[model samples]
Target: MEYREVELPACKSIALIAHDNRKASLVAWCARHREALAQHRLCATGTSGALVAEDTGLVIERLVSGPLGGDQQVGALIAEGKVDLLIFFWDPFEPMPHDPDVKALLRIAAVWNIPVACNESSADFIVASPLFAGRSQRMVPDYERYTASRSAR
Candidate 1:
């Protein structure tokens, strides 16, 4: 795929998502990073979002529950260039009914070059990077070329 560079704002728009089995871990992770995270815009899938809000008193733009289409909602935001970071704590041990959606969400994040963290250690590393608190640039797929080629097929 062809690529183009885009700038990420110093103050980012971060999306948080988690499966049922991973909610507590995500919420705890959010709480641990509450202060730093408070500086950015936050959005999340339903139940997890609510729990994070209640636990940390940080406001979150809550989408629908994951199985109820929240994954698609977040994916759309990623594709639209709205969300800069994705911290999805999904359960790999158990299969979810919406597994396909989960996979799609991850794929879209990658396609858009959004930073993502799937666990506590990864989250720690991501948030600790100097770039996390500063404006930076990333490479993303050149969607115009991709769309044109697809239409020609």
Candidate 2:
């Protein structure tokens, strides 16, 4: 399916991430919205990306493995204003060794004023919003500033 650019702020770039356990749910969810999601750019971490691509037949920009810095890479994309939406189906119940990176990714989205969906419910909320059909410009902080702050600390 060819997903054209929609009006939503996140329609420009959408990041798809899911933990090992939640990969299936994420895949299932994406399959349900394949048509809508196809309208935007899709990115994902190594394993997750591979799995999703295999399951849904969507070409995804694959990054490194999450525990191996994939999450940080995607987070950098968000900080750099390259990503507009983040859909991360994380398993909060399990402790991840790379939790810090994941948290940082989510925080970067927040710091940059981008919309992020951490769970299935929020993903639905974001995808269903009329704004998803209308492109809206949002003021975001400078990527340099965020990087500088982290460096300073």
Candidate 3:
């Protein structure tokens, strides 16, 4: 597939997601980074969003519950280039009924070439990076080129 560069604005649109078992940890992490995170646009799956907002007092756009299609919502936003970063704290030990949705969300984040942090350590590193607070470029699939090539076949 062909690729092209896209810019991520300094004030990025960040998506947060956390499994039931990891919600507390995610909330704590958010609280720790509250000051830094306040500068960005934040969204999350329902319960996690509420918890984070309550604990950190940071505004968050809440979507449906994860099992109720929140993961897909975030994935769609990522695909549309509306989300610049993903901070998902999923539990590896527990089995989720909507596991396919979780996998698909992660897959789409990779496809869109967005920065993703699946755990607190990675999230901390990403937040601490210079790129996180400044404009940055990322290579993504050149969809128009791929479509044109396919149409010419």
- Each model's TM-score? 0.94, 0.84, 0.98
Highest-lDDT candidate: 3
- The superposed Cα distance between candidate 1 and the true structure at residue 84, in angstroms, equals 0.4
**Residue pairs whose backbone atoms clash in candidate 2:** 3-38, 3-39, 4-39, 7-134, 7-135
Segments of candidate 3 deviating more than 4 angstroms: none
Instruction: Please state every model's RMSD to the true fold in angstroms.
Output: 1.6, 6.9, 0.6
lDDT of 3 by residue, 1-153 (tens): 999999889999999999999999999999999999999999999999999999999999999999999999999999998999999999999999999999999999999998999999999999999999999999999999999999999
The local distance difference test score of each candidate is 0.94, 0.84, 0.97
- Which lDDT tens digits does candidate 2 get at residues 1-153? 111222335456888999988999899989888888888899999988998889888879999999999999999998666888899999989999998998898888887777888888999998898766567767665545667778998
- Candidate 1: 10-residue stretch with minimal lDDT: 107-116
Better of 1 and 3 by lDDT: 3
Cα lDDT over the full model 3: 0.97
Which one wins on TM-score? Answer: 3
